[model samples]
Target: MLVRGKADRASRPNLLGDLDIPSGLSASVGISEFTYRKGQEVYSENDPAEYVYQVRKGAVRRYKLLSDGRRQIGAFHLSGDIFGLENALVHRLSAEAVVETSVRLFKRQSLENGAETDANVFHRLLSMTTKNLRHAEDHMLLLGRKSSVEKVAAFLLEMDGRLTSAGLLSLPMGRRDIADYLGLTLETVSRAVNQLQREAVLKFIGKTHREIVILDRLRLSSFDIPG
Candidate 1:
């Protein structure tokens, strides 16, 4: 299914939007509250996933756990995005709210039942899944082929597009998380970031290492490989 653009008139309303779903459909969905302190687990792998979540605020990370305690973070879900969709039996990857966060949730059974009866809603869900898959595929290519600087540049560009505000971009995750996401070591991430700073691609802000100002948007876009 073709995903609708945010500015398109035909765009569907997100959970945070004002579009009114049918009462029957809306009744199947209800909000739930969850909180995770930094490094806390929201849900473990193989846990029964009774619901799928939409981020109301903050961020979440989904990752796979190896038997030897190695972890590969698959993706991060930020505000206005959805996550926690899983098979009927159990969750394949573990999810954790990246900070103190709250999410709006709908029961898995309810979502399935709603989907069975509502083609439009089902299409919307599938479209969301498709968008996620596309990002994962693009990230896989970045991980496999991109240089460390290129990867970091691509990551910054992505975050800039998705979350920048008034010339400043605030990273929701830490350097270690960024390293894992980019398939680089933390030192590598630091070096690439410092390089970007020295090159006037971005400006560092604050001592906490969360805020950055983009100095050259066009140059940053050039780092991403053509999709």
Candidate 2:
């Protein structure tokens, strides 16, 4: 269940952090904020694409169910990241809160209406679409061509760039989630992470290995290669 924030739109910092929506365009729409507990379902697959969301805090995972009853995670949306943006009528993947997450959302129609008359808004929307496409292309290569270590290295580098805080890369998802995202088995992912640690590329911090500190970023990047 979505627990909508009581604050009005005017009190919010920005309408769309990724889109950097114009103040005028944002004022015309009613943005609703909601908080979801860890493991809460945000939306199911094939649901009507009524809204687009921006992460205010915490993270979300978007995934699809495979034929053999396996879950394939397509993407992980971190703080300030956008999700559920769609040009189609329905969502392709189901979304769930990876942790206690807060998100701001607005109807998709508001953006559509704004884009019709505003070239700037239209361009921003196009840019976002292109970004998602690029990510999809990269993921395809990672899953099909990369080795287990390479996949884990690539994932660490990605989290380092996106959500690393105070020199520590604190990952929200677990081994199972990482395995699904990287198209690897849980043991493979675990071994890869341990290998990186043994090689002195990264050190596991905190009570769990999810809290990591990259000791040698260049070495980690070298493992990722083009994929």
Candidate 3:
């Protein structure tokens, strides 16, 4: 069963409104809000795709486990990002909170029902799916063809655009999480970051390794392989 709770006014702006889903649809179809602690599982792979989620605060990591006990992270969803809209009835990847997180959940069945009666809802659903597809395609390119340096550079640029504040890119996940997402080992990711720092491309801040400042945007961009 979907847990029910009130979504504060502060979090209203981060809901389905960004996807252009009618506000009326949320109340009429029933929306649930869930709060998860850091490293907690939001949902597991092959679980029923009962709800679509929008991050209200913090970050989420979507990943898959291999038969041989290895793991591959697909993406990290940040605040205001929607995820878990699978094409089938089950989620292919498991999602977990990278930090203490709150998310607004929409019943997938209710959403599908709304799409049947509303053209706008249908269009928005299609648009969201297309956006996910494009991201997957880009990730595939990065995993399949991009060099180690290029992959790390692209990752930094992505986080810079998504999470940078006051000139610092505060990454919510650690090196191991980043390595899984980029299909590289932890040592390789560390070396790549160190190389970039050595070249004055970026600088680390504070004691935690999660915060960084991009000193040369153009130099960073040079390392990204064009698709």
For each candidate, what TM-score against the reference? 0.86, 0.92, 0.92
lDDT of 3 at 198: 96
TM-score of 3: 0.92
> lDDT score of model 3?
0.87
- What is the Cα-based lDDT of residue 218 in candidate 2? 94
Local distance difference test scores for all models: 0.75, 0.87, 0.87
lDDT of 2 by residue, 1-227 (tens): 77876656665657564455667877766778899999999899999999988888889999999999999999999887778988689999999999999888887898888889877778988887888888888888888755899998888888899988899889999999999999989999999999999999999887767899999999998998864
Question: Any runs in candidate 2 off by more than 4 Å, and if so which?
Answer: 6-13, 16-28
Please identify model 3 stretches exceeding 4 Å from their true place. Answer: 1-7, 14-16, 21-24
- Residues 1-227, candidate 3: write the lDDT tens digits: 23334556774654556555667776765667878888889999999999999888889999999898888999999998899999999999999999888887878888898788778888989888998999998888788745788899998998999999999999999999989999899999999999999999999999887999999999999999665
Q: Give per-residue CA lDDT, model 1, range 102-207, as digits (tens).
A: 5666677776776678776677778777887898897888787457888898888888888898888998899888887877889999998988888898887999
Q: Backbone clash tally for model 2?
A: 0
TM-score of 2: 0.92
